[model samples]
Target: MSLSTVQQVLARIYTDSKLRDDFLTNPDVVGISFGLNCQEIQQLSKLSRQQVDLFARSLKRKRLGEIRKLLPLTNQALGKEFNPLFFQYSETYLPTGNKKHLLDAIAFTKFLLQQLTTDNTQPVSVLDVLRYEAVRLKMFEGKRLLFCNRFYYHLETLINSLHSDSPLIPYPQPNIGIWFRLPNSQWRSLFIPFSVKRKKIFSFHRLVQKYLAIQ
Candidate 1:
């Protein structure tokens, strides 16, 4: 096989835990499956499994760091649960291409949402924050221009509490936020309390225009 083929196999082994385990357990079989010749298989098998494992762990840590940077608010909100959850995500899905980090963040966000939905134990505020950050990430990637969501708690308060490392008390306070990217490529958000009792007819266009004028 070509040297590039060997490199591809090695890359997969490093990034994929299950494949690494299989290779370590049965190197020749795995090598042959990847079209590695006998000599190449022997060379691969000669490498220390412990070193390979350490390198794999280091790669995972690096990926985790990149993902954390991309989803800072989600990472902060999830706290201790974040790393383990991300590690789990990385095991199943390995992102590729120039936008790999962004893809990883987007995929991990969806994974988190599914997990939260299944567990149903994490505070609803977490879901709200996760979604908001996901939207921000999508906006950054130019995948979205406008986004809107209704949050059960005050969005700014929740974000501030996470940043300040203060206690999170999710008192019910419904609010709606509109996020959009400006013509200059700057992102902005507008928040209005859902409980705001308006005497006049509500016009979303007027509301957005009024907020934009104030800004």
Candidate 2:
């Protein structure tokens, strides 16, 4: 019932394999409560109207049964007061390879969660994830490569230069991969694994606060 509990529930849902699978496989799960209009959802999903219709058709009664099983595990902390508009915004800005779209998706998800939870203390929202993703994708040349051990020393300097007031957080600058622009004008980078435990969220939040302080 509390905000922390709600976040935990959502986190569990995020990590739930069965829920993720069901979400992707079920057409019914796609349309309901998306907070977006049909046209908007179509545009965001990059699917034509016919494709959306076909996808919607796949949501049979049998699949709903599967989602029902998981529904009771959480106390519907999502609340019963569902707004079609929220889903419209959420569904209309679906994640895509497009940088603009992805950034919008992350920001909108954060906003929706903020609205639902009404808690400001643990401000780890989709925006944090987006920031992490952006930092993960950022490319630096020469001695600034800090994503890996080969240049760990350089990473410390780059981070120190952040001055606890810089807009950028201190992420390891070294990565194993190169960056390139995709056909869609979105930037892509294939890098070695960058692990983020729960603690990093707090660290990033602090970084955000520190950045905001000087501004």
How much lDDT does candidate 1 score?
Answer: 0.84
Candidate lDDT scores, in order, read 0.84, 0.35
Candidate 2 wrong stretches, greater than 4 Å: 1-51, 56-76, 81-86, 98-105, 113-215
TM-scores vs. true structure, each candidate: 0.83, 0.20
- Mark the 10 consecutive residues where model 2 has the least summed lDDT: 70-79
Per-residue lDDT of 74-193 in model 1, one digit per residue for the tens?
Answer: 888888999989888888888888998998899899999999889896899889889888887788788667787777787778888878878765666777778877577777778777
Pull out the clashing pairs in model 1: none
Off by over 4 Å in 1: 182-184, 195-210, 213-215
lDDT of 2 at 7: 38
> In order, what is each prediction's RMSD in angstroms?
3.3, 18.9
